[model samples]
Each structure stands twice: as C-alpha cells, then as structure tokens.
Target chain A: MIWKYICGSASSPLSVSFSERPRDGQVIFNSGVYLIGVKSGLLALSARCPHLGCQLAYNAADRRFQCPCHGSQFSLKGHRLKGPAKKEMTVLELRQDHECEGYKVIF
Target chain B: MQQTADYGQQTTDNNHGQRTTDNGPRTNYGQLALWAFHVALLTGVILSFHYRPWGDVFKSVSKISGWLPYGDFLRKLHYLAGQCFLILSFAHVLEHFLKETYRRIRPKEWSRLVLLFSLGFPLLFTGFILKGDKEGILAGEVMYHLAQEIPLIGSGLARMLLRPGEEFFLLPYLYHTVILPLTVIFLLDRHTRRLLPRGDWGWPFMAFLALLATFFPLPPDIPPYMEISHISGPWFFHGVQLLLRQVPPLWAGVIWPVIPLLLTALLPFAPPKLSKWGKRLTMAAWLIHGMILVAAWL
Candidate 1:
C-alpha cells in the first residue's frame, strides 16, 4: 500500500491544505500515477485523460487537470468537467496505514 | 434556349454546323454516366475474379496487383472507373441545378438525384474499407466507434452493419460490390430515361473510357503495418473528419452529414417564393463543405 507512505498520519502536522497556487507538494510516482494534497484529503488520480489517451497536466491556477491534446478538464476528485472526453479520470483508492508515518494506496 | 410546342422534341445546333433533333443541349452527361457505369461494371467483374472477401483481403489485393498478369491494370481500371462514375454522377446533378431542368419540368427528380448523389459517398467509403489495409482498418475503427456512440441503438447497429471480428471485411465488400452498385444502376437508368429520352449514346464513350483507363492506372495498396499517425477516411469524408476533430462524435459523425442531405432532399418541396434563397443556402452549404475539405487537406 503506497498510500501509507504518501499520505502522512492524522497526527502529522505536515498535511498541508490544498491551494490554488503552484506548490511543490504534488508527487507523480509514474506516468499515470499522481498524488496530490487537496482540501478534502489526499487524492490520487490517473493522469491519463479518457478522451484520447493524452497525458493530463495539473493547472495550479485552476486547480484542475487539463488535457493538452483535446482540452478535456477534470476536477481534483477525477470528475470530468468539460471537453470531448466521455468519462471521468480514474480515481485510485487510497487508505491510511496506522503503523506507517504516511498513507497507503490500494491497488 | 429556344423551345418547341412538344416538350420531348427539340432542335439543337451540332458541332458540324447542322441542326439535330434532340432533347435540349446534348451535354453528354447522361451518356458519360452510362459509359462510366459500364466501365466500372466491366472492371469490377474482372477484379472480382481475384479479390477475396474474407481473411487476408489485403494480401489478395496485393496478389492481384503483383503476380497476376495485367491484373494490376484491371485493378487500376476498376478504381479509376469507380472514381469516374462518382464524378460523372456529380456533374450530371450539377448540370441539372445549373440548367434548372428539374425545376420547370420535374421537381421531384432533383430530390431523387440528390439521394442518388448522397449514396455515392457511402459507396466510395465502403470500397476503400474493403481493401483491409492500414488505412482501411483505421477507417473501420472510426466507423465502428462512431456507430457505437449513436445514443441507444448504436451498438446493435454497429454489430448488424459490421459483423463480429474479421467477418467485418465481408460487409463492406457486399455493400461495395453488390448492393450499392445495383441501387445506383437502377436509379441511374430511371434518371437517364426520364431526363435524356434519347438514351442510346453508343460505343464511342466506352472507347474513350478504355483509352483513359489505359493511360492512367491506380497504384497498389500499401502494407497494413506501416507507421502512419494520421489515419484519414476517403477524400469525400475529409470535411466530416475535420468536423470530428472539433466537435463530439455524434454531432460530427452523424448530424453534420445528415443535415446537408436532408436539406438537399427537401429543397425541391420548398415554396416557389423561397426558391432563390433555397438555392443560395444550398450553394452556401456546399461551399462550407468544400472549405472544410480544403482545411483538412491543408
């Protein structure tokens, strides 16, 4: 469970609130795996836009994912907002590990 | 532009400075359509001897062009003749519009002609898809996806239109070879009989088509595994393809094409007072279509 290491414990003061400004807190483990700290909680999203398999870029100013190829937009929760993409971005399941210092992602 | 008492009977000046009894100006479009149809049929028959409908269709097409003697020539002739038929039919329709032949005498004929003309695009597309090459495969994929996206009955329609798996190749082959050709020929015969009563435009046009076929032969199909990024449909569909990139699949793939066709079919029934505006609108629609096609090419 990778989420355990990514998402800090509930007692940890390091859990930063999500902001609309550019931050260094976002972590991309691989091409499609992305981990970001949002106001709701730690959100993990598959960066691939469902429209045409183009990689999505996170826009800090808008706090949304935007596809460079077809301009498909998605919210922080992986819900599709606009553009030609028919489906939402895939949201990966994440869980907290009590023994670890961070969170664990359920594959 | 002089008229006689009998609508069927008229006199026209010939190329040799002699007055000939015929129906209006003999633009020979009907004759050209007849000849092109014949040439297409002949070449299709010849190509059918070698073209297999099922598995490895691309290979069979290649074999026809590569191994069989004069097979390549026949294939090219068939391809060219089909293209010629499309062009000739379009020209015939345009001539009717320009001459206003359909308005004064038979208004319904224009709608029928438009229907027939509309059928030509699908015929051409199905022919291209039958090749089963890289481009053909891509075209099939586009068609399948587009069909699948059509709201409720999409999946069922796609399954019916393009069977399951490799058998999909057979559907377009049937359409290109049998169904569409027969329908076009039937409509063409009726159209020619009504418009050009003097239908016997003899063997000279056939000879001309033969000469043209001999001079220009089509190239062979490319291999299926080629590295190509931009897969496009037939030229007539280029405009729609352009639209597909900009809009949603349903709108671009279905609605855009259907709109023009519906307008063309309904144009003849428009009130006489709106005839001028109707013609302008139709022309503008075609102009927009042409522009989209040009943009796609660019």
Candidate 2:
C-alpha cells in the first residue's frame, strides 16, 4: 500500500497520478522527476528520464534534478529549464496537512 | 520599403466586400510538424515502458508484464502514436514538397537535410528489433549483419555490439527513438521558422496523441524477435532499410532521402515544364518507394 502523508501546507499542481507503476517493460513514458519546493523542505524526484529510462537525482545546490547518464537537469519546481531533458518534470502534489511534519514524497 | 497591397485582393471582389483585419503573422508550420513529431515521441516514450527491448524476452506477454506502470495501455498508446507519427511526417513532407517549399531554400540550407538519415527507416528498424520475437530476431540479425559489412569499423564493432545473432536491442531502441530524434529535432531547429500560436496542448498533445494512439492501430504480430530471414520494418521505413541491404547504407539511408530536396530547392531555375517533370518525379519516387515496400513484405 502507498503510504499517504500530507506535505507542508499548500498542496497544488495535481500530482497524484504520477505515482502509479506499470506492468513494466516498454511502454510510453513521459517519465520525469518532480523538483518540489515546499515550506517544509527539499526532496528528490522519482520520475525516470525520458531519454532512456534513467533515474534522476535532485541537486539541491542547483535546485534541480539531474540525470546521471544523460546529465539532464530540472529545477526545484519540476520545470525543465534545461536540456538533455526537453520535457518538463512530472509533478506529485505536495499535500500540506497540519499533522504532517516533514516534506514527504510518494513515488 | 514600398508596400504594394494587392488591390485585386480587395473584399469588394468577394462575399465580405471589406478589408478584413484577420490577417496576422503566420506561424511556423515546422513547429506544428515538430509537435506532430513529438506526438509520436510521446507515444514511443510510453510504449518503451512496456516493450521488452530484447528479442528473447518478448516470447510471452507475461514475460514483459509488471515491468511498466500501466504498461498495457501505454504500450498500445505508444504504438498508435508512432503510427501516427509515421503518417504525419510523411504527409508533412509530401505537402511541403507539393507546395514547393524547397524552392525558397538555397542549396546550403537544403543540403543539411542529408544528415536526417532518412525519415522513418532507422527509427522503425530499431523499433521492430526491440520487439523480442521471431520477427524481431531476424530483423536484429539483418541489422547486425548489415552493420557487419563495414570495413575496419564494421566487423569488430558489429560482433561486439550486436551479440552475434541479436540486434543491439535496447541500446538501438533508446538511441533511435529518444536520443536520435532529439538530435534531429535540434538540428531541424536551425533551419526552421518561429513558433505558431496554437492550443496550449500543441506541445502537450504529444501525450494526447499517445492517448489517441490507442484508437487506431495496425494488427501487430507477436514480437518478431527470433529470426526474420525476410522481415520488414513499418512500411514507411522499410523502403529505406531494404535499400541498405543492397545499395549500401550511405546510398539508401543517407544520401537518397536528401537528393530530392536538394534538387527541389534548386528546381525554381529548372524551367516551368521541368517543375512539371519534377512533380511527376516526386510521384514516381513515392510510387517506387511504395512498390519497394510491398515487394519486401511479400
């Protein structure tokens, strides 16, 4: 089961469906990472790079997600704003609930 | 610059009978073409998640299952999107050529098209090779063997890369669909026009096409991965691949697709009847391409 937790206090961008997994193999993928900024903190994107299904890492210093193999980067808010990553990042809604403590990402 | 507004185009000559203000700067049709191209790209991206990439793995649908998130639907979407891409790119080119767009481009600009490596061939070549079935295997073999024909670079590289009997598989698929197309798109930008004002989904419709791809599809065989002594790529690309098998890669895959554009770009000076001849030549070229594809499938 997917663990559900609300993020900071403002949840927007409608990023819920990004968490679903597929049968796995070769299917269509607009796979991209979500670089999210919240009142709570920073987190890495779970979306795969469309280049070759390579996973991306979040570069907090740069405030972006970068693909290891292709070296594509995305900003903290998931806007591409970069190359080797033509498409924009996939967004996961950052749910902000009063009870939620830290920035929790579900992927 | 003295502007000569054509009095002949006056609204008085037509039903509206007044100067209409609807005229605005035209947008880049190339960008629209790019959007169409991206639709196929999105379809391909979604499909990649379900595809086996290696010919051996495609033996059963069960094998590839659980690999992707929402793989089945996306896979179908990808296939349909690719098919649409194939259709649209050709239609885009066909319409452009018919309109004599090349007439305006100089030799220098027209020549750059040679690097495109042929429209659908390489993409489809690597695409079918990733299917992981008997047909895919044969296609892989064809591609492997074809690559092996290179002199110093050919033999060693093919063996090292293709795994003898199999296609380079995933690597080619990843390269052809993603890396390569992105490259082509990048290159095409240098020779294209400004963006057209259209729907917000103009770009987002890449995904929409994939979603729509589900509606229209060609009947797919089980992956042709094992061994295709005689296999064909999607009908569009096969015309070139079949050429590479006999005419050498440089001739069919590289040089041929561009020569027409080069000639057409220069065609404005070739006398009016020559343009007539050129149009016929294009029709003939298209006809020959179709015949060659049909022959290969047979």
Candidate 3:
C-alpha cells in the first residue's frame, strides 16, 4: 500500500536509529499530529485532546500534550495522565519513505 | 333600638371611607407604562413577521417601513412605545429614589428595579444594532472590541457573546427581540404587582397610546453607507460613548458602567445602620451619572 507523505524527514526530530531513546516531535500537517520516537519505532498521535476536542499543544517541559480549552494532560505515548478527558489520544500509523527521505503518516 | 341602628350605620360608613382612603386615586404613569409595554410588544411581533435579522437587515427594515400597507405605522408605534416605556420607567425609578422607597421597607424590591433599569439600556443598544445600518454595525464592532479589551477572559467572553464572521448580527437580534423583552416582561410583572395590586386603567391607556401612535409616527432614519465617526449611540448610551472617548476601554466600557449598577443592586441589602449613607451614596452615583450624561450631550 502506498503511504501518503505527511511531514518532511526534518520535521520529526526523533531518529529512526534503534539505539536512541524515545523523544516527542510535533508535526503540523493535517489538524495536528504528534510523533513519538520510541525504542520500538515511531508512533503518531492526533493532537486533539479527547476531552473537549480542543487542539492539544505539546509541552516540551513536561514531555506531554496539554489541552488549552480544559486542562487534560497526556503522556508522550498518548496515555491519559490527567483529564477531564476520559480517553487517550488517537494514534496514527507512520511509515518511512526512502525516496522523499521523510516519514509519511498513514491516516 | 333606634340609637343602636344609627350606630351600626355610622360604623359601616366609616369602614367604606377607610377603604377609599387606602386605595387612593389612580395615576396615569403606571397605566401609561403598561399600555406602552403592550403596544411595543404587539408592534414588535408584527414587525418580526417581515424582519430578518441577518443578510441585509437594513434593507429588510426599509422594505417593511417604506412598502407594505400600515407597515410604517406599525414600525413607528413599536419605536414610539419603546421610547415611552423607557421614559416612564426612568421617571418611576427617579420617583422611587427621591422617595427613598427601597430603604425603609423593601430593599430587595429596589434591587430588582435597579436590575431591570440597568438591563434596559443594553436592550436598547442591542435593538439599535439590530437595524444593521452602518452606524449600527459600527456600534457592534465597538462593542466587540470593547469586550475583547476586558482583562483575563476577555477574548473568550467576547467569542461567546458575539458570533464570528458575517453572521455576527444574530446574537444582538436574538437579544433585542426575544431574550430582553421576555426578561423585561418577567421583571415588569413583579415590579408592577409590588407597586399596584390591580391595574384597572388598561383600556383607556391603550386608547391613549393608539392616539399618540397615529399623531406622531416615528420616521425611519436613512441607513448610512459608510461608518460615520461622529455617530453616537442612542441618547441613553451617549455618556458611555463619551466616557469611552476619554478613558480606557476597560474603565469606561466595563468598570464605570458596572460600578453604579452594582451599587444600585446592592442598595437594598445595605446594613440598616448604613442605610442613610447608602441612600446618599445612591443619590451621589445617580448625580454623577446625570453629570456624565449632560457632559456627553454638551
């Protein structure tokens, strides 16, 4: 299946290298997508906070997503840390494209 | 037996005299207010049949005013009745204030009256803006920006109060035609009952309003194409506009307008020992308001 290109390779700050520790990256393509680089691979999550559907902003200091409308906090991996929001953030699938030298996010 | 019969007759006469003294003669003002309220409401309902709040309100208003048989008359009646209601209500408030009616007996009643009175101006402002003329649109923009200037949650509050984009006209229209009238009616019912147990002069008052509406029909002002800078709001809001020109939006628009209203609302709840001071304070506040109004006019 052909994967759609979402963000440029430089957009995701996380390296595809297996040895590197996981870090959070925010890519603004459609709505908002957050890329989480982990030991296993790269994970993409929707930036919309589940609680009130407000766009979530990535908090670099806390390494989590925080909602602006209501204070709902989610961990880098989309786990609900604190919420008026009951559920976790929606995760998206992303694939690496060698031709574009960038990660293509699958909707 | 003859003496006993005379005494019983005298007692019955005294009771009848006492009842007459307690009821007092009917005043024209309250009746006038009642009639005006009804006339305004009726004409407003009639006007609403053709008036659309959105998409060229000025044109819609003009169509109703210039075209349709008796449409101009109905619109005039509505406008005149609203003015009459405001005038009568202000007179009533002043009468109560001078009489110190709220302090000795029903403070809460006084507060309710103040609340109703305070609400009237905003209702009027909203009504003017519903015209959707250039001046009216300008007023809306002024209000939106003023609301946006409020500290802390100003932007959010503004967003909640005003609709975004071209549909901005809807909120004020809803407020003017529906929300405000309903609220005023609810408050007026209570206020009227507190003042008079029975309103017996409805028919005559209605007749009087009809006569007034016929003789002095309200003429619609031409809607301006471009925003005229000199254009002020309705006379009642002239003071606020003047104040806004001088002071910061936060002070003139929000705080200054709010303080007097707050004081008026809390007047009835003032401590008994400070009741005298409260009355003085209230009077002072109103006097300041009067001065501002005069200055605004000048």
Which numbered prediction scores highest in TM-score against the true structure? Answer: 1
Candidate 1: tens digits of C-alpha lDDT, residues B1-298 = 4322122234452222323344333566655665766777877878888889887888998888889898877776677767767787777767656655545544455676787777777777887887778667657656776787788999998876677355868888888889988887777665544322244453666666667767775644656654332456787788887777578878888777777677766777779899878777877777788898899889
Sorted on TM-score, highest at the top, how do the candidates line up?
A: 1, 3, 2
lDDT of 2 by residue, B1-298 (tens): 1111111122222222233212311233334445665555765665555555544456434344445555556555555555555554455455555655445434344434333324455665566656665445445555555455556777786665456323447566666667777776765554442222243446566656655645655346554322112334456556665565456454565456555545544455566668778667766766776787777666
In model 2, the Cα lDDT at residue B155 comes to 72
The positional error of residue B108 in candidate 2, measured at the CA in angstroms, is 3.9
Tell me the TM-score of candidate 3's A chain.
0.70
* DockQ head-to-head 1 vs 3, winner: 1
Scored against the true structure, residue A43 in model 2 reaches a CA lDDT of 35
Give the winner by DockQ.
1
Q: Model 1, DockQ value?
A: 0.06
Total clashing pairs for each candidate: 7, 44, 0
Candidate 3 chain B: 10-residue stretch with minimal lDDT? B1-10
- Against the true two-chain complex, what DockQ does each candidate achieve? 0.06, 0.01, 0.02
> What is the alpha-carbon lDDT for the whole of candidate 2?
0.50
In candidate 3, what are the lDDT values of residues B1-298, reduced to their tens digit?
A: 1111011122222211222222222245545665777778888888888989777788988888789688877877787778777776666566656655555435556677777777767776887777777557656766776687788988887776567456768888788888988888887776653322224565766676677777884544547343122455677777877776456667777788788778767877888899788778877877887899999889
lDDT of 3 by residue, A1-107 (tens): 42435544445532232222235353232335666776677787876556434456777677777764345688888999985667899886877767655666665
